[model samples]
Target: MAKILMITGDFVEDYENMVPFQALLAMGHQVDAVCPGKGKNDSIATCIHDFEGHQTYTEKRGHNFTLNAEFDQVAASEYDALYLPGGRAPEYLRLDNKVLAIIKAFAASNKPIAAVCHGAQLLTAANVIEGKKISAYPACAPEVRQAGGEYVDLQMDEAITDGKFVTAPAWPAHPALLRQLVALL
Candidate 1:
């Protein structure tokens, strides 16, 4: 089993955040979910994103996800893998300098890293996806491209692994994403 650091924040996709955290734990991996400015036992809000035949997914309030680790205390070397869930949270989480450093540390260490949907935003901010074929919600393709990554478009339920990076379009690709991650781990 691997030790994983799950970096997420308020308003992270409900299913995306919960499913992987639980699934990895069930697989005997130790997953530490953390959010900047939060500590163990603190909770973050989550939201549901549904494709309702609109131009994009619609959002709704979701469960309160509890944090099991303190963000300020995490050391990239302490974990064997990293998981980043997508949602509105990445938009702001990408702005935290420490967050960017943590992401870079993971990338530099050649550890496995997984990101879905808007999680690409953080990867781009950290400048770690360059020369990689990365996937994310279609809207994030431009950011991925601008970051020197080749944007890969795939079905909603698909995932792609390039080097140590595994990415997907959204939560629907969890099975594929996790499968690829398990292989990497």
Candidate 2:
């Protein structure tokens, strides 16, 4: 079983993230949900809703994912794969230099890195999509093209695996994306 680490933050797509995680777990892979920090108030930490609209909680596997752990602590060489779920979270994660460094390490080490929706934005920031083919949310098409990646307009019918990178469009394509990710495991 592969040890898959999923990185997420606030405003992440609750359902999109869970489908793949559950599928991987069901396949006998060890999946860990690594997040930035504990949530406040009534907000849940390290959990999201599944596609069926049920709440799914994540098991804490690492200290809060910050600039330090993302870059200096967590080594891409230690994991079989990395997964990034899209939403407003990517918009902020892409700006963190450490996150970018970790992303670059994943690309450099040739580890499988899967992303969806705005999550592909991290690939753009890490400059890992150059000459690669990928798919993201429609709004990010120009950005993907600008980053030297071919952006396809297909739903996640199949995962676009360019080298060690796997990308999908959005929530509607979660099933296919999860299947592809599990196959990799």
Candidate 3:
């Protein structure tokens, strides 16, 4: 099994955060979910983002997700891989230098990094996806291109793995996403 680190924050997409965390745990992996300013036992607000015949996804309040690790205590060396869940959080998390640093560390070490939907926002801010091809939420494709990465627009169930990085369009792609991540591990 691998030691995995998942970075998330307030308003993280509900399924994106919860499913990967639990699925990895069920697979006998050691997972530590952390938020920038949160610590062990701390909780982050989550939201449900889903399509409902609207022009865009709808958001509704979801469960309060608990952190099992402290962000400040995270060291990229301690984990075999990294997971970044998408949502409103990445819109802000991308601005955290510390978060970007962690992402860079994983890339430098050639460890597998899995990001979904808006999670690519952090990857862009970290400048780790340049010249790589990946899949992400359709709305975020422009950011990927702007960051010098080729964006592969795909349905929610498809995933793309280019080198050590694996990505999917959105939460609905969890099955493929996790499978790719586990294979990397």
Candidate 4:
């Protein structure tokens, strides 16, 4: 079994955060879900994002996700892999230099990093996806390209693995995404 560190924050997509967290745990892997400024027993708000034939995805209130680890207490080297879930959180999490550094550390070590949808936003901010083919929410295409990484426009249920990074369009690809990540682990 592998020990994986998951960096996430408030308003993350419901399915993206919950499913992988539980599925990975169900697979007997150690998953530490953490958010900046949060500690063990602390919880963050999650939101559901889904498409309903409008302009983009619609959002709604979701569950209160609990943190199993303290962000400040964990180091990237302590884990074998890193997981980043998508949602509005990445939009702000990208502003945290500490978060970016953690991502960079994982890339430098060449550890398997699995990210879904907007999760690629953090990857772009870290400047570690350059020369890599990364898949993310379609809205993230520009950032991916600007960061020097080839943006892969995968189907909602499809995933792409380029080296140590495994990414997908959204939660619809969780099955493939987790499988790819686990294989890399």
Q: TM-score of every model?
A: 0.99, 0.78, 0.98, 0.99
- Segments in model 4 whose C-alpha atoms lie over 4 Å from true places: none
lDDT of 3 by residue, 1-185 (tens): 99999999999999999999999999999999999988999999999988899999999999999999999999999999999999999999999999999999999999999999999999999999999998889899899999999999988898989999999999889999999999999
Per-residue lDDT over 1-185 for candidate 4, one digit per residue giving the tens place of the 0 to 100 score: 99999999999998999999999999999999999988988998999997799998899989999999999988999999999999999999999989999999999999999999999999999999999999999999999999999999999999999999999999999999999999999
Could you tell me which 10 consecutive residues in candidate 3 have the lowest summed lDDT? Answer: 133-142
Residue-pair clashes per candidate: 0, 0, 0, 0
Pairwise lDDT winner, candidates 2 and 4: 4
Model 2: ten consecutive residues of lowest lDDT: 59-68
Best prediction by lDDT: 1
Q: What is the lDDT of residue 136 in candidate 1?
A: 98
lDDT of each: 0.97, 0.72, 0.95, 0.96
Q: Once model 3 is optimally superposed onto the true structure by TM-score, how far is the C-alpha of residue 135 displaced, in angstroms?
A: 0.8
In model 1, what is the error at residue 63, expressed in angstroms? Answer: 0.5
Cα TM-score of candidate 4: 0.99
At residue 172, candidate 1 shows an lDDT of: 90
